[model samples]
Target: MSNRAPLSNKEIKTRFEAALMGNYGLPAVPIASGSGVRVTDADGNVYLDMIGGIAVSTVGHGHPRYVEAIADQAAALAHTSNLYLHRGEVELAEKLLELVEARGKVFLCNSGTEANEAAVKLVLKAGKPYGRTKIVATENSFHGRSLGALAITGKAAIREPFAPFGVEAEFVPYGDARALAAAVDASTAAVFLEPTQGESGVHPATTDYLKAARRITSENGAALVLDEIQSGFGRTGAWFAHHAAAITPDVVTLAKGLAGGVPIGATIGVGKWGDVFGPGDHGSTFGGNPIACAAALAVIGVVEDEGLFENVLALGERLEANLADHPAVTEVRGKALWRGIGLAGADSAAVCDALAARGVLANPVRPDTIRIAPPLTITAEDVDLFCDILKDVLSTAPEGPNHE
Candidate 1:
């Protein structure tokens, strides 16, 4: 390695602001490196990574096994496009099907949005024969930013600006079976749902609600699409959160933690819905690359071998129990490792910034909700540290929203 000095935070910020688009605005912290469940910023300030790259770092940063898989795959073969069949892709697809406990076909993509886009086409084609044109989604739900996926995303703030969304969709209140049943009718092509809504403050749909969706859609001949993009791959103590419902969905979308921080996504079509698309239907250039598939395989293997699911359950219980009756918290939402701590009168954003300053990373998902999804591989000690730091930060949390 060269003996040159590292870029200072100010220098890095200047170049980043000048070069990158303002879509994400300015990054609050400039991360330099990560290991296990912690990350160091540009100024060498270390913080426990509670959010884990927005729930994408499944096996944690720089895991030896995960890194080895990625490196080995890249050295052997990286990109083959979708033209040629690859082993990693096939194996990953088979493994996902086995975990879902259903016979299905998997369509690989590079992100959750692309997977949802493929889902749109699948539902559209599946419904074409029945003259069904409408889709149903839940209010406050976030699917993706792409035009096709945005059509079904019910959050009006991000979705409304790109109006004339092309697809016909109805919004229903999440966890309300009656509204979902009422919305999904003969003309409905599909009912898209998140088993646990992650982006809009980690709210999990009830088991009964999901079962109702399955039954209602089956009766009306509409596809039941579960967007497990944020909840899948053991984030919820299971391969997929919908597994708890014991009802097979027509389609399911996955990404985020699938490849443990590597960019990858998958749209799984179950049963008859699997055969919806044939040649020339849809495709992605970098979808299901060997490196991504290998990484996903490694993650699955590690999670299973190390019993990380059990770890998630144990640590989750401990963490939730500690925060349950805290004075600064109103309520805790979500299941297992995926959680949202609702603040009591305190502003979520301000609390998060305070926590960051004290060496912990979290996300203010909503004005009053602070979301924390730590790596499943975290130990009991790590959980305790998080709880202690969170309590300390809350003691001096800013009174309200930062007006400045």
Candidate 2:
């Protein structure tokens, strides 16, 4: 019951350890401030932020435009609840629709989990009188960890704990069009796939696989839902990674970089499915608040106005090209800033730790795979610096047990 404020990193860590749950282990660094693509720890150590808060900060930290927009929105009005219409929400939805360029309507929420949940509800509602309840998702896919999303997520370790939810889902091997086709049936309500599997080591879906899913889902009367929570909003150089496959999904779930760093999620349904939810079907109290919508509008404007997509494309190419020839890097995968570097015989965790110790930050999505999802605005110099640091870290990283 101490009301005392923490004065140092050590004090803050101590307070967190005592008061917070240990689900995320412990934060490696106590960050005090961040700007552009860099963050400084309370201990005065600065590090290049390659993770971008796990691909959430698309426009990068403390962008002046984003700051101004949030400030202006807060000054004018913050929350009016979803019962009332707000101009910022309408503007953001319109901008998102223009970017996707498919016929659709958006349902806003608070996070990736909520977005997927909203999508699941919509699909179930639309397919209802049909008695379709099954969903088809791919193996190694990582949807958010909510009950409904967890059931659809392919990872058994996360789904097994909540068996009583009674949500039936089938998982097929990723990148296998035949397997995906075989899994969907007449009773399937939806087929969920990530354009690029983020938490499962950045595995991009093949064009054939995506097209096959689109075809099979349509044939089976199932909605094709693409979870672009991690790969959307210029993370993959394109507004949506599925654009590369040249197939439009029935539903698209988005979050992550939508509002730069602000927490927001959107479940957009294309064509007829967009109107599945009526006035009382689904809603969130803080979903389309003026502040978050304003933030998203600002983020979208900056991405387009500043041409961050081209930057992502150029930097992503350089990143992959530089690492492609590295002896330690087995394979470099992904398009744009969302990249996965597969290590040959080395442990990715050790390399990530080594990189962190050398004033750089990267993450190991799996034991053998490290994901590098820097901001869309990351510069060529930043990519070069990251490559140099990674090369040095790989050269000196100790051979040890691998833990993801």
Whose lDDT is greatest here?
1
Q: Which 10-residue window in model 1 sums to the lowest lDDT?
A: 395-404
Model 2, total clashes: 0
lDDT of 2 by residue, 56-169 (tens): 989989999999999999999999997788888888888788888897899999999999999989999988789888888888888888898988988888878777566888
| Alpha-carbon RMSD, each predicted model | 1.9, 2.4
How many steric clashes does model 1 contain? 0
What total of clashing residue pairs does each candidate reach? 0, 0
Instruction: Give residue 4's lDDT in candidate 1 (0 to 100).
Output: 75
lDDT of 1: 0.92
Clashing pairs in 1: none
For each candidate in turn, the TM-score is 0.98, 0.96
